[model samples]
Target: MKNIIKTILLSVAVLGMSSCSEDKILDLKPVNNILSPDAFTTPTLIESYMNGVYNAAAIGQYNSTGANGGRGYVWGAAYVEQGECRGEDVVNMATFYDLTYSSTFDATSANNVYYWVDGYRLINRCNLMIEGTTDAVAKGIITKAAGDDYIGQCKFLRAITHLELLTYFARPYNDTPGATHAGIPYRVVGVNTQAEIDSETVKPRNTVADCYTKILADLNDAETLITTGNSTAFASRVVGRASKWAAIAFKTRLYLQKRDWANVIVEGNKLTGAFALTADPYAPFQNTTGRNTSNSESIFSIQHAATSNPGVNAALASMLKDRALVCISPIIWRDADWKTDDKRREEGKFIYTAAGIKYTNKYTDVTNRTDAAPVIRYAEVVLNMAEAQARLSNSAPALTLLNSVRNRSLANPFPTAGNPVGQAYTAASFATDADLVKAILKERRIEFLQEGRRWTDIHRLQKDPIASVATNGVPAKVASAATPPTAAFVLGNSFAITTPVAAIPYDDFRFLWPIPQIEMNTNPGLGQNPGWN
Candidate 1:
């Protein structure tokens, strides 16, 4: 990891070469030290440099030369595939994510290796931005407010990158008491000179609890310093960039993962009037028409453009919709809970049929592949608060919050009408708090089907004390080659699988991905996750 960060720092000269003309600040001549004092001069240059950091971290387009070589790195298709295929909600129908689907990935697998390499690469860029912006403020090149905003954005990116790495590399927070398991190294400083690189190479991993503490600290600082409105002197106020609400929304996710119910609600309440879910469930995924650009539901997303995309192989539309590499698994698609008449299930809208298999149409730009990757959404914050309320036995507010997200997509009425029509729950619907929590979990599975959120639920719920909300491990999945039923699909139809893949037990070491072999080779002091050679 340290060696990879050193390489990324050294290669900063070619950082934003593929970005637009406004973002071409880093296309300067190669130099021995690109982070010299003169690098942070004008507002345009500083903003462009920060744009390069965002391009590397959120867009994953700048540095694609290391462990994953030609394949696009994380924050794009690789990010979506890794998160979705690890669980049973999505089936891997091609070779791209087969190893991930079957939990057979080793330390040398490209997916895990590149995820670590690119994640730290992004983190190092954020560190450099932090240092550069602070220096610019001290030298009076930029105001204190401007410098703080830049630092806040860097911290937000840094926090998110570390959280993503923890989801894959470390065990669940509840797997052990106090979350004392090994966590990834929280890189807070930039690696520019040879001495800094040497010092970073030997840093040991931190505990999961420690990692979460650092993540929350960064997010809190970001919430305080980041701008609040949608407009600013620079382009940092756009939807894709971090803001006060985005930091708060992300804190809900982190607190939810840690099972801190009160904190989740506290953070969620801060976003009550700031953002709201779109009336249409499919509104947030419309990229070609620019509806997603001003989507009220999207809190923060990874921006992609026609000229600057993850390419055909790694684009979300290409893999999930056009090429049909992975499709919506029957495990969730055929469940009786997901209504047949729901807007999300309507053909050509969110779900599309190709060769009798259902693929997600959430991403529509197969040619341009410019679909924006969603990081956090208003729906997720609502659901997080809903689950937190249910856990606390506050059933009334929980059901109301759940319906706010669920009612929009429910267009048709069920055959038997009552308070709970079309799968909308009421106050008397759940007999127990566990049942309400289970319903909230199911809603999460349905609402966030292909948005790279399935694995997050599975990871956090694996060791849950409540039996209904807990998952044993990766659930049973349909065979990759198994064909859907020839008859017309119905809400309750059972799509029998001729070859059922067994589930990985919670105790299996494969439950968590191995530390990349490259990291082990470069930093021998770093320990590997058990059960991987």
Candidate 2:
């Protein structure tokens, strides 16, 4: 009976099989696998299981089909693409487009559903590692120290995966500080038996606050267990695993989402001298010469080798190349007024061709999908601190931090002379805290253009009801809080100009994606988010 139970628990359920784009929901293909009582007895087996957890966590939207960039789902770089596509930062060319830009996606939407399904898949893997590690220690299969390390890593993945789900599924925690908004069900235990699966499935969703509490606890525990003592040796391994600093950085992001401005500052300060910005503007992204080794800048990145990448069609190169499916928005080129010599505009970063198309070069290698997926970077922490300070009305300090990022892009450190060429912003640019805050926001848009953050940033800042680029021959530069203009200009099929596009309101129901319909179907206790039934 025990052997049968172990097999049932270890077997891959239909619910466990995740696809590239997360579109497919099929029947279970159970494997006859079981964890013997002493499966975690060897260090090598434990390491292999932990690596599997990492692999599961890194899987994002990449579907390897012929259509849709010949890919099923685009995961790593696709996150940046999907997040920015909905916002005003990037554009799609004639050949490629998706529901991300459409005003129609909701709870039944496959893209949104994928986030929930894939996230829990990651969490489940982590839970298994956590359980196996604990069991190994209890059975004297591994030392207490080794067990702690395994447990810490698994918990860190679980925490971040849960947080990512909340970012999509639940309203921002700050949206309703004291209110009871249903967040995704918090499951920490690995499902091994039918009873465990049933129990977890029917568990009611936790309140957003309660969910946050769990996320923070996991992060804090991870921080305690993950080591940073062996910096030199660990640097090579840190790209794939969570380090002590990585846990702290994740907390910084979590605080920002919760709108805990002071806590953001508090947590961000922990990385004071831990990481530095890459001296060259584009050095951090080069797959061959750059970022092959861990640096002070990258806290954690998903590792993809030359032999193993997300796929051909699912890479950023496929989506944002000159003749590629997606393109950069004209607004970024025209309205935002990017400098001519900006390193970001250099041939490899953004390409401008004779046909008047713009492509981002962040993911330059298409044939070999070895580009590391950046989860967190040192620069983001600096900006988060800058924004937090500005919000707290700490004027002088915020501007100083903001200028550091601005100076790096131009390759011209500030407090020098006149505006050096390629410089995006300067120290004397803003006068008030609000002005500094706005500049910081603008800088974030420029900095993380293809890093999959525009929509969430827009959502967090409450910058909504965004209007079209050109309305009746004039630029609707600033997002309108009032009613949007009808017949707004847009790039449509074949790059043709389409007009009268509706603006999304700040409190639009679509802003908060509906709970995945299948999840609601399976878990009767789960309730749908507002505006999607």
Candidate 3:
């Protein structure tokens, strides 16, 4: 469940994940401000308007479950039918979690929708401001130089919104791509041509690839515009807003998705000295004093106010010190296999309870006060670099970086075993680079459990499958259609189709979301994505 605090996050960066009510504020704007429209002719008014757009981007539901139920119960029921750990192609995403879906919009989920709409809404506003300011500059209402800077900020805000939307609404740019797929409508300038749109709106969805290109263009444009100085992580120029480094960091992630391995190696190499890995990987998440521990490892994060969503997101006074929603399950316990030293998990998730049962304390606020929510940590760079090297057949040295991270998590140096073959440790048992990658996925899971990275990592790797807990399964109708039913059964009767892999392959048609049925009915031009019925 998400906490619905009415307070704004103490934000430095304009990564505006706030609880502020914009529609109310906008509706209640002073008549003179609306009437004078001339007020927005000045640089001060234009900048203030631009800042509001960032506020729109940050405010969204921290979590939203389905109409049927939240993950635990629905997942609990799902596991009973499928006998699988968890179907990663979760059915609720497009159906239940989509804020744009007609019935799902509410204040709880409104932030995400509002955040998105606000960005575009602001984009329209920016366009209006630019047009007006140009007219004003020509007539002496404002200066041309001031107007240019304001427009650049608008571009950055527009790009950031699109990027976030692309990540959420569309499939990963690297996989089941947006090229053939229809991305969210690309709205640049504000236009509510509803009547005209109803009759003549023929905007074809851009391919996911096209959306990525647009995102890159905006970021590139933002870099050129925002390249002055970004010292503070949360300054008005940097925090709550996109900065040059923040843009690059985001670019790096996009490139990684496209599997531009060379760029991954290059960009990752270039960032060599920027991030510092923690001796204890969990410290960045649990240490209150060391919340921004990843100031060394993390590139950027949309810092939240301790008041908005409270601990449900990241802030003080939010039972994060004492409460638990996002916690380690038996999945990690089973995955760790009792083989590796518990050093990482011990430091990362587990704390001895009064009865001595090892209870997870990672999300416990004060006891393991890791206030920082990492967006991109240095270890990811290290992992990405190693992955790049492995992909390049230079895996012999990849272990150096891998070992660098592994050693820190270990209680003591692992005594080398067996023999040595060239750079390959003879005693170590990874038959090939593929084996190493499998290991990397396993390591990533151990390190990033409950950090919102598991499902996405699967999108990128698409190679390995970890075992899911006694959870996750596909609908019987779907599973039988492909593999064919071994038997017939009633809907309520419980049955299981056990599989070794944790994540079941999504029925092929499920690769992308069905264009919402309403959209299909209303807009003949908008086509549905493949795999939907």
Candidate 4:
């Protein structure tokens, strides 16, 4: 925490100069005196500071300064690769993500160490924004409404970062009766001075339940404070910035992870009329035309541009499309449940086939690498509600919500007299609630194929009582060096591989990532996860 804290304080002094070329929210000018009293006095200076925080959280320090600097929450970094490659749906074909793919990472692994460092760095920046905005309001530098909006954005970033850390560094919420397992430190105070850094160094990790409580508290605050009418500055920046609907949509994700079915529905209901799925599956990902902002499906996204994106090395297009470091694994690709005529499997759309190898084209900017990193989407919200309703035995509404996303990709979504049984799911389609839930989960895998969401579902459902969809641990996958079929891939064909990596059971020590070695050395109070030492 000391090293991470020091970085945060140092970054605050140069916040204005760290602006990246991004959407209007991130187009900031340099502020000569950022640390002076006049820093938060005007909208321009305040927005410049906010832009720095968003840049740090979105793009990170990817300038080759250090190993972890290349990875951030978005831009095909730790959150994207680690979240997908660690699961079974995607195959790792290169050395970049091998440790994460094979579950062989240790405390000192670059991915493990820097993910923790960058996450905490972003958290502290949010803290600084929160504290700075409160002071601004007190000193009459900004209005109460404006201050609340800034603080709301800070809280939203803080809550999401903490949750991301918990997903990797700690056990699932259901691992214990009350989620009493060790959780990551939820920092709310900004550390600027030497005294603050020293004080933050000795703080201990919170329990998983307590961490979730704090996350929800911050989100609840954000829900109330982040509104379109509060300030003119915020109303115009709704596309890229957090809004009331984004906060509600995020709550659905958190509640789904916790298995809070009723709460999931409650938060999901608020987004009913606010957003809808796009008619085409690829509409949300048309990066060249800025569809990520214009599309109705996107709730909140981290916008990227030609100049400000994680370059070829770490961009989503580079990793998943152009370089093909990670390919769509045959495991999900060969599943018969995914209809043969599904539009998502169509070449040149979401997927592309070349040299008999299949790659995801979800991020299409192979050269420019300017694809927007989707944080939350309306489809996810619909699926969240669908799963929650299925869990509570409300089958009709569940199927309706499920088809809202799944139907768009199917060749024939609705039933007709000529084709009585169309592709859309019916009430009779599932034998039981467990069956319905399983179908919804499968839809999530296909809908969010290469968007780095598979591992999150795998993580939260590891301890599910339902045996069908509950994952034991990391499932077996095609070997890293497994060869693709020599012939062109055919729909529903058995593309067998001779070598398959075995599964790691739930009880394995490697199930959870170890605390970074540097954090352990710097902060004596912090303890590592089991089997790391």
lDDT of 1 by residue, 1-533 (tens): 12122233212211212112323222221122334344578776788777767666544533343221223456755777788988888888877788888888898777777677668777877887899889889989999999999999889989988898899999888878999989889998776554565667667899999999999999999999987454422223466788878889899999999999999999999887667788888888875435345677888877776766667777788788888888888778877778777898978888888767788888888887777888788999999999999999998899889999998888743335553454566777788999888888988989998889988788889878774436578777777544545342445554464427788887888889888765676565678888886
TM-score for each predicted model, relative to the true structure: 0.89, 0.82, 0.63, 0.90
Ranking by lDDT: 4, 1, 2, 3
Q: How would you encode candidate 4's per-residue C-alpha lDDT over 197-259 as one tens digit per residue?
A: 556666788999999999999999999998652222322435567777788888999999999
CA lDDT, candidate 3, residue 65: 23
**lDDT of all predictions, in order shown?**
0.75, 0.62, 0.43, 0.75
Give per-residue CA lDDT, model 3, range 75-111, as digits (tens).
1111111111122221111122222211223323433
The per-candidate count of clashes, in order, stands at 0, 13, 30, 0
How displaced is residue 247 in candidate 1, in Å? 0.6
lDDT of 2 by residue, 73-151 (tens): 2234546665766676565444244456544576666666655655675577678779888988898888888888888
**Number of clashes in model 1?**
0
Query: After best superposition, candidate 2 residue 142: deviation in angstroms?
Result: 1.5
Which residue window of length 10 is worst by lDDT in model 2? 467-476
Clashes of 2: 13
Instruction: Report RMSD (Å) for each prediction in the order shown.
Output: 5.5, 6.6, 10.8, 5.5
RMSD of 2: 6.6
